[model samples]
Target: MKHYDYILVGAGLYSAVIAWHAKQAGKSCLVLERRSHIGGNIYCEEIEGINVHKYGAHIFHTSDRKVWDFVNSFVEFNRYTNSPVANYKGEIYNMPFNMNTFSRMWGISTPQEAKAIIDKQKSEITGEPKNLEEQAIALVGRDIYEKLVKGYTEKQWGRDCSELPSFIIKRLPVRFTYDNNYFNDLYQGIPIGGYNKLIDALFEGADIKTGVDFLAEKEKWMSMADKVVYTGAIDEYFEYCFGKLEYRTVRFETEVLDTDNYQGVAVVNYTDRETPYTRVIEHKHFEFGTQPKTVISKEYSTDWKEGMEPYYPVNNEKNQMLYQKYREKAQQQEKVFFGGRLGEYKYYDMDKVIASAMNGWEALHR
Candidate 1:
């Protein structure tokens, strides 16, 4: 067997960056990806000349300058600001509970007018919020919560708001400005061509094998490298010794439409209970592409099962406690180092994932 300095598992963002840094340091790396494609969840498929976001809409946004510069070095990013709109039973409103949303909801213009209405509605929730329903009402008001928060949240978790823990929505962002920009991050955009370009550049010097399950042949892979960088699910890596951690995954139904445009925006969140899917994403709008045809994905948020791809971690108390037990066991593995969303069991943004990889690479040397 040809030995390598690092056996980077999962060719996701974390693994790709680690491979890049390892190659830079003149170290050999062997990358293994369980998925058929290289980009992991960030994988894009070209449909009708449009790069469709295979998983869901993954808009890269972050405040850290180092992380921003690192990705930009591989591929230049476009100025694609996420100004998503919410559709509640046919009524459209600007997202992030902005001034425009309040105006459309209450037919008011001034901040004072919107504030007064919200303050009055907030009075309904007197004591400490017992559930997500009360928490949202207390934060924004009943009108916004009922119209925007209620059905959408229920669909997301497959549970009524009253049954969910208050901490799930610790704080809801309410902006008085007319801005619809979702994230307050300093930098935001997608790769100029597509995300594949960035992934290819990052893993250019590495030896990668796709469609190989690292968990299935752990010993064989472990023998190939001095140290391992595992990015798969921590629980699965440990064979679910402490019981499986909860996660919320999404199902995407992608379609190549005949028309040039569909929703007119990159993202439109269906906030109504009747709408089965949470959001509709038009891939062309992400890069401002003037393609003759468009591709769209109807995103349906579902609870994680044994076979489904885990998208978001259900960071409830129970799951976190189980993860801690796994973490304790993971610490004892001297030859292995875990990183990324599934490894750390936290919902990490794209830039944060890169930052974690950068930090992990530095720690490897130490």
Candidate 2:
């Protein structure tokens, strides 16, 4: 039997990066992925010459220079800025609650005019905001909240604004400028070709085995390696000893349209309570593809259950306390290292995930 220095539980970005680093350090690694393929949630499928995001929309944006440079080394990225449009009952407006949105909402051009309306509406909530509804109104005023925030948030969480906690939406950014850029990060773009190129580069020298469940035969796999790097749900690793952590999962309905274009932009968010799905994404627009046919995916947020692909972690008071218990138990395992969104039980963007993986590698070496 072959012995290995490390056994990675998941072949996602976190594990891929660690595997790459281990190979460079003259160490042997065995990467076991539960999914049939690698790249985790960032995996994309090409249909009609277009790279469709299989899981959901993942735009790489980061303010960190080192992180940006690190990813660029693997694959080139296209200049695709995320300027999502929100459609409220067929009415279109720019995202991030910017000046373009205010102008269309109230037909006002100046920032002062927009500010006056928001300030007046915000004053209605005089006392501390009790729930998400009041909290949103206090932050960006009633008009923006009603049309853009209320229904969309409710649909995402599967709960009404009144019932949801205020902490979920601490603040809604209301930009006074005409810029429609969704992110404030310095570097923002999509990987050219697709995210698989980056994943392929990361897995160049690593021994990867897909469609294998490490947790099923934990003792057998652990015996092959000196240490284990787990990236799956921490709760599941312990067989739900402290109960499962709550997560919000999304379902995608994708189709190839005959027409070259469907929506002009990459993302169009349906911000009305009546709309069943939250957003419709045009995959071609993400890479500026000129394919004859276009592919689109309608995203619907649903309550997560066991055996489902978990997306957003619910970091509420109850779940947080439970995760901490799992964390304490995880720390006691001297031969194991927990990382990634599910492992850490925290939401992270693509760049942040890469940065985290690099940090984890450094920690292990030092």
Candidate 3:
């Protein structure tokens, strides 16, 4: 019989932001999370004094100053820059395809020498690239594409480059500089005490319930609130009237190592076709931990089913069309509003999700 101004579903970044704004506006809000805990994929657990990124490695990087300021308000971020290395058959190279990588690969130092080498190799591709393989070759040439791109991309999508569409990799970033920083963002770092600090701060004024499936008892929850802000799968919200949308999920295999360091860097991508997992993440490196032991997670990409934890939205032609239909149906519902990665059927970074939720809150208030 308790009335609430808003019933926010999912308790992820999107829902947390909405609930925060709702509190600021003097509105009573309730957050219902299907999982046992909050923070969604960004949730971290402390093991051996190291915060393990449970789902996968989530590096918070954003060019937006507003979003940067917004998140920093909750928790202070450490000066952690993502400079991932690629291990191709025991040979290591820096990521973002920079001059350092070029130097290591072909003993070329200057940008001019690297450009010439790439340009020469790129010329091999004839007019109008058809597939991801051809498009990548056309962009950065065969050497970089073969060693760095092909296998990693193949593992991520669970498909070969030739079979996938060119639009999947519209542009392979080829940095001519010596910069190995993965992102060109103005603000980037991991939260000092892990992402849970931020999530806990965000949900301060909201009533939260975990291990509760909103869809199971939809009507009961819906009646308590004036409006429902759903951040779960859009198809699930509407009972998949237009069929299910496809997604690429990830499986994490985490281990506690006896040694201080497992991998020198935070992220090391295995760019070999034979490698089962795409990347190995050393969690301690993310926070500059000098612990006696370290925790690492090997990430494997998999096809998402109804019960699996959906990670990346496969925004291909068919899925997009189906999502559009669901979106239309969502808009027709007067009391329900959809947001976040799953609800929108789009891949969004953490910063973008926060900005989106803030925007959604503003729109709802207006």
Candidate 4:
């Protein structure tokens, strides 16, 4: 049996960050991952010299300067602004409903013209929105709602906009500026090297055991470590005593083309109900690299079932209640501290996952 000061139950950014801190604090650590490789959800594989995100697209965007600086230590990042395109029945439009999208929709260029168009559209809706469709029309008006938001949102949730809650759509940001930058974060980019390489470097000195099931040897593993940092699904950690929480999942269909370029953009979102898939991603665009061939993947959102990979937590009231019950159970385990997206049942981006691990390490002292 192996032993260590701390046993990290994942090899993702969260576990890597925690292991880094544990090593800095003079604590021996062991990281266990069920997958053959590290980097968890952010793991990327090379195909035709292009690094394709094995999961879905993971763009690094964060407003936290500390999180940015922390990630920069392990790997240098490249300047790649996210400018996703939306396809509505073969009619492509710039994403984020920016000035360009506004002009295309209304044949107007100035901010005032765009506002007047939106105002005229909003003036027709007099009643309170009862569902997502109504709410989207109330915010961005009918034309933009029909073309851009409706189909995509429905595809993502696997439900019609009319059936979904109004709280889901809430407000659609219609920017008056010409900026196509998807997120308004201060820092946004991709790693110079693939995420897999960065994770390997971060775990160079740490004892990591991939393809090991922590649950199978739970008692033995727990006894081997001085403390436990669990990063698996919270309900599974507790054997689903309170019942499993619902989640939304995504399936990816990848294809390698012999051509130099598959699509010009990194991500092209299909915002029409006619298309079964939600988006198609060209991996090379993320790194701005030119190769002999290209790799592409079509993403489809689906309902999560047993023995399938769970992506997003169903943050509805029912799941929230179930998570709260699991959280209470977790708090009672004095020696085990839960962290990361799966462990906490929260949706976390790349930077936030790293920051969470750092914070988890600090809290161990108190």
Model 3 clash pairs? none
- In candidate 1, stretches whose alpha carbon ends up further than 4 angstroms from where it belongs are none
Q: After aligning candidate 4 to the native by TM-score, how far in Å is the CA of 237 from where it should be?
A: 1.0
lDDT of 4 by residue, 58-112 (tens): 9999999998988788889999999999988988899889999988877888999
Where in model 3 is the C-alpha error above 4 Å? none
Stretches of candidate 2 off by over 4 Å are none
lDDT of 1 at 129: 96
Where's the lowest-lDDT run of ten residues in candidate 3? 357-366
Which residue pairs collide, candidate 2?
none
TM-scores for every predicted model: 0.99, 0.99, 0.99, 0.97
Query: Which has the better TM-score: candidate 1, or candidate 4?
Result: 1
The TM-score between candidate 4 and the true structure equals 0.97
lDDT of each: 0.93, 0.94, 0.93, 0.89
Question: Model 1, range 15-70, lDDT digits (tens) per residue?
Answer: 99999999999999999998888988898899988988898989999999999999
Candidate 2 worst ten-residue window by lDDT: 357-366
